[model samples]
Structures are given as structure tokens and as C-alpha cells.
Target: MSAGHTAVTTPQPRPVPVEEPVIRCETPQDECGVRDLLDRLGDKWSVYVLVELAAGVLRFKELQRRIPGPVSQRMLTLTVRRLERDGLVSRTVYPTVPPQVEYELTEMGHSMTHLVKALSDWSIAHRPAISDARRAYDEAHPA
Candidate 1:
């Protein structure tokens, strides 16, 4: 053992505390409602819309452009509508010749986005491990 050397350690980042109370499912009705909302929010299109809106407000066309795979117009419309219904997004329409419209995240939406962003960060950080697991599974089981 060296007498002069000291141990070194990496510093850790502080964690952000969750401020909002999670929705509780105490009854059958409550459980159904909560599950429905979660299902809608977890869908692929909804996640994409949320990611785009997290940046700032955007018109419908802008949302369409930002999301990859060029989500269909009907699908985009449906996704935003569902999010709006759930109070996570606000829609503003301007009375003009073309009827300008824009969508932005509500206060609650921002809170939800924080959680989504954390999940996204975690996914990116562990992508290598996820791929390795998938490859190992595929190799072990051939079609």
C-alpha cells in the first residue's frame, strides 16, 4: 500500500425533486381513467409531439416537419387533439385569412415533459446496453 497516495472519486450530480403528486388509482373508475391517460400519453405519435412542443410553440405544419417519418396529417391532428383533451397542450387559433393556429405546452404539460425528458435521457445513456441485450437474445434464438 502507498502511504502518500489518496483515493479519488467522481462527483455526482444532484437530483431534481418531483413536485407534483402522482395520480392515485383507488377505485375501478379511477384506475380506468388513469390507465387511459397513460396509454394515450405513451403512444409513439404523442411522444413525438410532446418532444417537439417541449422546444416551444409551433404551428401544425412545423410539428409535422419536426417529427421524423413524416407522420400523416390525420395522425398528427388526432395526436394533438388527444393531448389537448388531456390538458397537456393548448391550441390557439388566430382569425385570419388562412386561420393561423399554434400549439404550446400547458403548465401541466411542462411538468409532464420533465418526466418524459428524463426517460429520454436514460434511454440514450443505456442505448448500448439495450442493443447488446437484443443482439444476445437474437443470437440465442434463431427463427
Candidate 2:
């Protein structure tokens, strides 16, 4: 209560109103094309195969080698089949003395290069955070 001091009231900031997210749960079957594509893209193996194919057309063996870890023959078969059916990948067979098969991205799949690349970039950037989380989980429950 100094004689020359004046009490000042600070203005309170208004809370930012969070607008509810518009969730369109109802979409006509016709508009489901992109949604279907997104489902395919979201698949773990599908995205891996797509990224590998982006380098160039690869033979089945090459794809198996390039992808890290061991993937079952059945899983690879199913993933490729799904991608092919979705028109995102193309499989070609060359009739040689010993038949050769190669998988390549179709025009539609090629269109997703930027999106996939962005995802790859994000993964690299966030790897430390992901690793830290894993370490924390392991520490919380020791074997």
C-alpha cells in the first residue's frame, strides 16, 4: 500500500473455442474410392512394398531382399495381390528360359510417391521419440 503505487488488474485471455471436428460418417458408395485407396495405403506391408517399388521395378527376390526382416511368402503374396487388385501396382511376367516376374508401381501408385515420401521423412524425424517410448516401456516391465 505505497502512496504512489496503483493496483492494476490484468486482462484475462479468452479461451480458444475448439470447433468440433466434422466427421462425415455417411459417404455415398461412389465417393468411397479414395477411402478404399487410403485403407490400402495404410497397410504396413503395402506401404513397404510401394516404397521399394518407387526405386524401380524389382523382381520378387529383389523385393524380398530390400525389405528388412523376414516376411513370409504368404504375406508377400497377399500384399502384392491386394496392391495389384487395387490398380496401384502391376506385375509382369517375362517368358524366358526360366520365367521372370517383376513388380512395378502403376501410374496410380506413382502418384502416391510424394505422400509416401513425406511419411518416410516423418518416420525418420520421429525415430528418436519412438525409440525412447520403446525403452520406457521395456524399463517399466523388466523381463
Candidate 3:
């Protein structure tokens, strides 16, 4: 109790609402298109390419070297071509005594890295549980 003194209340900030994403298949064409894209992005080599490109711009050989395992030149070329065709990657060619080419992610490709990283984190976190489940399933269905 003070002489003519009053307490003022502070305004509380509202929390941002989170919305669930919706993927609609209003037409057969839409479903087919989604599946086609999923197949392209979900293939064995594409994700590896994306992860490596996330580091920085790289030449074709550098990209090939960075990716682990015995990946064929043909396969890598095909993967990059597909990514570029999808507008997720850009290819630059420089002409000189010998031709030079470099590959980098487009804006769409950069945005997709977030989803890729999330998937990678999820796989790492759940690997142990997945291994346990596989082991249990194998034991139960011994043949």
C-alpha cells in the first residue's frame, strides 16, 4: 500500500500455433506424380548427393570422391541429371582447354536439406529400437 501508487500488469505474448501438413491426391495424376517424385528422392544415391552438396559447391569428381562406397560414374551422373531436371540442382559448365563442370544445390534443394537432416536425425535416434525389433522378429520367425 503506497500513496497513489498502482501496479501495472504486463501483457503476455501469444504462442505460435503449429499446423500439420497436408498432402492431397485430388486427382490420380497427383498421386502418380507424388509417387514418382518420392521414388526419385528416396533412391539410394540421391540423398547422399544432397548431403554432400550441403557442404558447399563441388565439381563432379569432388562430389564423387566425397560420397562413400563404390559408386559408379554412370550412376552418379544419372543422379545429378535427375536432380538438375527436377530444378533442385544446377549444373555449370566452363569451357577452356578442357571442359569443367560444377554442381550445386538450387534454392529448392537447400530447403530440402532441412527435411533430409530431420530424417537422418530420426534414423540415428531410432536405430537402436529398430535393430532390437529386427532381432526380435528374426528370432520369432526362424526358418
Alpha-carbon lDDT, every model: 0.86, 0.85, 0.88
lDDT of 2: 0.85
- The number of the candidate with the highest lDDT is 3
Native-referenced Cα lDDT, model 1: 0.86
Q: What would the TM-scores of all predictions be?
A: 0.73, 0.64, 0.77
Which candidate number would show the highest TM-score if scored against the true structure?
A: 3
- Kindly list the per-residue Cα lDDT of model 2 for residues 56-95, writing each as its tens digit: 9999889988888788878888999999998989999999
Ranking by TM-score: 3, 1, 2
Tens-place lDDT per residue, model 3, 111-130, is: 98998888889999999999
Off by over 4 Å in 1: 1-34
Ranking the candidates on lDDT from highest down gives 3, 1, 2
Displacement of the residue 138 alpha carbon in candidate 1, Å: 1.3
lDDT of 2 at 41: 79
Q: Give the TM-score of candidate 2.
A: 0.64
The true-versus-predicted C-alpha distance at residue 37 of model 1, in Å, is 5.3
Superposed by TM-score, candidate 3 places the C-alpha of residue 46 at a distance from the truth, in angstroms, of: 0.6
